[model samples]
Target: MTTPSPSPRLAGHLLVECLIAQGVKDVFGVPGESYLAVLDGFHVHADAIRFVVNRQEGGAAYMAEAVGKLTGKPGVCFVTRGPGATNASIGVHTAFQDSTPMVLFVGDVASDTRDREAFQEVDFSAFFGPSTKGMAKRVERIDDAARIPEAVARAFMTAQSGRPGPVVVVLPEDMLTQAVPDALKALPALNPPQAWSDPGSLRSLRQMLLQARQPLVVAGGSGWTPQATSALHRFAENWQLPVANAFRFQDLFDNRHPQYAGDMGLGTDPGLRRRVSEADLLLVIGARMGEATTAGYTLLDVPVPKQTLVHIHVDAAELGRVYQPALSIQASMANAAKSLEGLTAPPDVPWAEWTASAHADYLASLNGAAAAKVCEGTLDMAAIIRTLSETLPPDAVISNGAGNFATWLHRFFQYRSLSQGLKIQLAPTNGAMGYGVPAGIAAALTTGRPVVTLTGDGDFLMNGQELATAVQHGVKTHVVVLLNNSSYGTIRMHQERAYPTHVLASDLRNPDFCALAKAYGYEAEKIEETSGFAPALARAMARRGGTLIELTFDVQALTTRQTLSGIRDAKGH
Candidate 1:
């Protein structure tokens, strides 16, 4: 009998094997000397996976977070110790707040260098530990090369389980090069089991719905499968309920559907806000009523709501964390929506007019935003957004960072299709300013589709260096920059709102954005008139590499509805 060849494996190669077994095809990271072994492992498994070389650790983390949001699986990222880990913390915090599943692996100093404040060393647990407000769900370090499989599997589990968030894993430089038996290969990645609601809770939810005259359904958070989204549609259609998506998750429900009630987030529809407050019953599904969604908790009374609250969440902890619900169903979105779809709505329900009126208010809000013509300014934001809405494909991915510039697109752009089986939105619910560029790059690389990123001058500069990354990767995305020459638009708007025109730190000085983009290998131009946008967008759509369109927006044009001069002029009105 021929003897089986002795299995030879390095810890880094073993880790890659485990990741492949778990179905991870892409990983974003910056190259580091500490993880040179892991880099080689990536080369060894080149046919199976790709290592996305990001310009900065922060951008890499953001890309990973976007992947997690798009796939509903834990997005994986690799970074080095100390500064690299710290730089990546922003994406970790974003995943925490956004309820995304992600795993961050940091290569650390050699095991012998422990606790001496070695070069590029950090206390992983202390830095990424869990708290009421912490970046990671769990932080762990693996000194034993043989234990990598276990750690990888556990990281996936921890990230996907209860209130899905990020997990941190630390690997010592010396240990990564250590040997692990090839026979002890990694097990497949684990998935969190779908938690189902109790039958009694479903019965109670049905009774509560029967007792309502004005019931509104609000959906948000991750963990929503296509099946769940379809079931939610069925549940809404069967009961003739008006549904709204919470915060940045506008794609959870089809916007074109008549039952849609618009998104509840920054610059929420006033009509929708009023409807939410006036409704007799609030059916919250898969969303945590956080500060932004609830308008700093003012929309819903804290411990108790003015309206009857029925909160259905994947995690049991989020149920009673905010508004105490009249009925709380603890189940995964897929299971909860499935259960809800089966419940019988009473034939004599009293909320028909209420639902119809809610949808009417939503339609009015959209019409109002579209009808208002340009009060002033050559580069009219309304027209620009209108052109973009008309030109882009129905399934086009819309990527944006935080700014007043986003207000224009958020108000006018309507997402109508799911090209990649997920929402086209790649915005950060945590309000990270530099999120758009990298997110657009990630979306383009993963989906192989046209990606559009709308950004302000300040927001663009935050992670604009990643344009070099896009150029290197030959990524094709349309980047629209609204330049209001020398001021942070959102902060300036807030400064105008609170302090009235003493814009101190909010004033920004920017480079020639067109020249900058051209230098980075993009087709770019500057637009000064409303009529220039559609042609620029058309040219971008036809371009080969990528395109950047810079529009000169007046600083006075602060928002979709109001201007800075208008805000200051009204003063105390």
Candidate 2:
């Protein structure tokens, strides 16, 4: 019996089919002229893969990152070469910093135009060098079609292994249209061996942890599965150690757990920093110990010696790259955590005293003015998070943009379930506005759950066009915009504090977001008074599809929450 040959179309379809087999349900991209062939391929399997058309490639890629963070799967984004791929660099870098898994498929210029400086023809491998784990260019031979699964498998493996990140696969326009043999149809399953710590290293780490009167466990980056988190939880509970999340990775630990010490990186709880610095041993896992995680890399300020650092990360490059460590183990976070769990016998330490201090500090931090006073004349950001926590199902995913408003949500909003926690999908370092709406759309589409995006007036305007996409796709996402009628609320606050006499390029005039949403064919409403917020939110969430609620609040209502510096540097301060 001879095996049947697969047509080019069939091969393309099978490539996507394997993606579906791997649990990929949502794909974010903006179709361009170059990717029409792949787009055509996608059209055949539209039911299996939900395609979301984003207004910008960067936004689409960021949306993929959001989906990946929320779902714990490799988020996929498709793009055309040249400008389309270039625009996605921000998102790629974001996934790198956040350790989120993502697969980026870029449509390349034809092989004929490879080096002719053809339109939209740039070396994608060179372009994505620093941002992605792996980059595969278009292969011409029919035999290379089988390599598609290998490329994809490696991409996913790189994405989920070590320091999780984005991986790019470039398909030349011609290659995507090539025919292949049927024998290549069966996708190879990827099962990389788990990287375990050496028995001697594990023993040394266990002894260090056990002997320390004050030991702290710092969690960061990605590669934290349910099993890894569970092991950490069990270890923390067994030894009564205070567990602190590395900056943005707070979602990995249960906030309600008595041993949880809250976030510990930049703008972290100051009290938590004091506690970490005072610890005799710092057991760092998965985290890169980046400058942000180490508060500008001032590891000594925390009063811990270089010899006290026991750093464990999947990437050897990351181990001791920032903070000198007495011991560094290059292994998988899950495997390392499991090994540590077995090596360490329970220690007799004053767990309650450490926990009591942390709990007291957390309570004090919450009682600050930032947590008090619900919105005066508009929807209070804090109240909205509290209400959402109370109203939404435990497993609902929430995606947020980077802005002053997001800071409030981060500090006040508590996740009952890991699946529903806040995800910083886009690279927050760039602090780009207008990602919340599209990201919310992507999250809802990917997770099949209610998606809530918290944005400010300035941010909503940046990506406001996405409301139409949401409505067109029948994506039921709730958009809550804090209408401060100002650009850069944090900057404005800083100006007021530093140079009270002058305010420049900070004040803003925004259009009526509610009216704008209505123009985009969405159910829209405006809430100016805090009193009507609950009823308005209920109405919005009850709607079957998209709803935009603009909450107008005074600019003075801006307050710092979950931030390191209470004030920024302006002319005076």
Q: Clashes in each model (backbone N, CA, C under 3 Å)?
A: 1, 0
TM-score of 2: 0.87
- Write down the lDDT that model 1 would get: 0.85
Q: Write down the TM-score for model 1.
A: 0.96
Q: Which stretches of candidate 2 lie over 4 Å from their true place?
A: 1-11, 131-146, 299-307, 368-380, 417-432, 477-485, 493-502, 561-573
**Per-residue alpha-carbon lDDT of candidate 2 for residues 465-572, written as tens digits (9 for 90 to 100):** 877777777776554544554567767766677676478988787777777788888787777765677777788778777777777666655664422123333333
> What's the CA RMSD of model 2 in angstroms?
4.0
Give lDDT: candidate 2, residue 202: 83
Candidate 1 per-residue lDDT over residues 15-71, each given as its tens digit: 888899889999999988888889999999999998999889999999999899888
Error of 1 at 140 (Å): 1.0
| Residue 493, model 1, lDDT | 83
Which one is best on TM-score?
1
Residue 136, candidate 1: alpha-carbon lDDT:
91
Instruction: At residue 476, give the lDDT of candidate 1.
Output: 66
